[model samples]
Target: MTHRISCELAEAPLAPGEVAIVGAGPGDPGLLTLRALSLLEQADCLVFDRLVSREVLALASPKARRFYVGKASRCHALTQEQTNALLVRLAGEGRRVVRLKGGDPYIFGRGGEEGEVLIAHGIRFRVVPGITSAQGCAAYGGFPLTHRDHAQSVTFVTGHRKGDGELILDWSALAVPHHTAVFYMGLANAGTISRQLQAHGLPASHPVALVERGTTPEQRRVITCLGELVATIAREGLTPPTLIVVGEVVRLADTLAQPAAQVAILAEGEIRDRVGERVAL
Candidate 1:
């Protein structure tokens, strides 16, 4: 069977000496935007991070120069300042540089800092927004961030504190009723988050969803109450790139979740498959 390619990108090619800070979306290559795809194809150099999926990187031109500058928790391949300087230097070299990030660069991806440096250096730059992890993960995890019966508002916050210190978030505000809170890079600080939220008035039995590798074929959703947030993560051995969604809306996953069987593995002469069901710990 032959498949026809019918995508029509409506953006002009990125000019030389220009930098395009594009979001690669949350782990799924199909979530990439048309402008981002165009920039990837036209870029002379691609600077990507660890969270960017290999599938998305595969969409780039084969001749494009690639730079791996991924920063993991407690480990740094390239410091933020170093990355900023590199973008400046690359644009100075008159290359069409594509600085690709895992999610929307403006939301905790630090695109603003890089844009600041670019402006100071008088380099031409553009930003292409991509679906944030909260949006992508919540959708694939089968939960709505906001619903009339569950949540009237939604907020996204970073759980990575300076030096992994105390997360200085508005716990009182987040504890309000009818609100959905999504925390990025929150798994390590899950204990603190749960404690603070409960102390601030969110009940211990409040619904929570820990979505691991969300929006990808290997996606895993662990449903648990807010009281058991940290314990649930330990029980499941969940890791970074996981998103924490807290709200009454999370309870809806019990009915809305889809199967994460796309990348099942055969182990020990047995096929371990996760059926189309939500796991509650």
Candidate 2:
């Protein structure tokens, strides 16, 4: 049997004079939200980063024009001024623009800066939340952000700074109680992080999880403790675009790794009394 190619995009529609900063969701095309897909479908022009997956780009309507602003790991990204100007110019031409990023737009993705520019220009814009690498990586790597008995609160932080010269993270603060702590773009600083966190009182043996490539088929997850995490990642040859998670919840990640299973158990065990059959297994 032969399958026919449909030029139709599975994206959604958009209104005129509006800009959508969409999260492409940690390199997995399926993680695209319905609203995000809609904006892509109706987008007259898409300003995307070089790191965006081809699969996600392919979802934009066939008629929509695609522009690459070229922001990749260790590569040249357009100046912030130029990028913001491009967005304004595109919208000035009455094009429905989609600023698509590799993961969630807000989580270290620079969507806030773009939003500031839009506000200054009085351009209408919307925010579309997508699965950040933290969520995506943790899910695909079998690490749960929270475990009932293990953790209660989760924190997300960036490991590197664009302008800062050194590892300037607040080590003392991060060493506090947490169910999980996720560090984005942190693979390169894994060693420094380990040393600093340990120096700040975080146990050297605290479990650390490094998820590379996140939700993609090429994804890899390394489960190790802080003391050995650096050596383990180096010996194993993992690359950037990775997330680092540290905490007690990681110890129970094996059991809560299943999305459907976690939901089911939460429903049947915890919410049964208050939510009744609504949460019934």
Whole-model Cα lDDT of every candidate shown, in order: 0.84, 0.76
lDDT of 1 by residue, 7-97 (tens): 2466556888999999999977778887788788888999998899988898888999999999988798899999988999999999999
RMSD of each: 3.9, 8.9
Model 1 per-residue lDDT at 129: 98
Query: What tens-digit string does per-residue lDDT give for candidate 2 at 203-281?
Result: 8889888777766655666678889888887776777777889998776655555556334224323311101112222
TM-scores, all candidates, are: 0.90, 0.83
Structure candidate 2, residue pairs in collision: 12-37, 12-38
Query: How displaced is residue 73 in candidate 2, in Å?
Result: 4.7
Residue 92 displacement (Å), model 2: 1.0
What C-alpha lDDT does candidate 1 achieve relative to the native structure? 0.84
Could you give me the TM-score of model 1 versus the true structure?
0.90
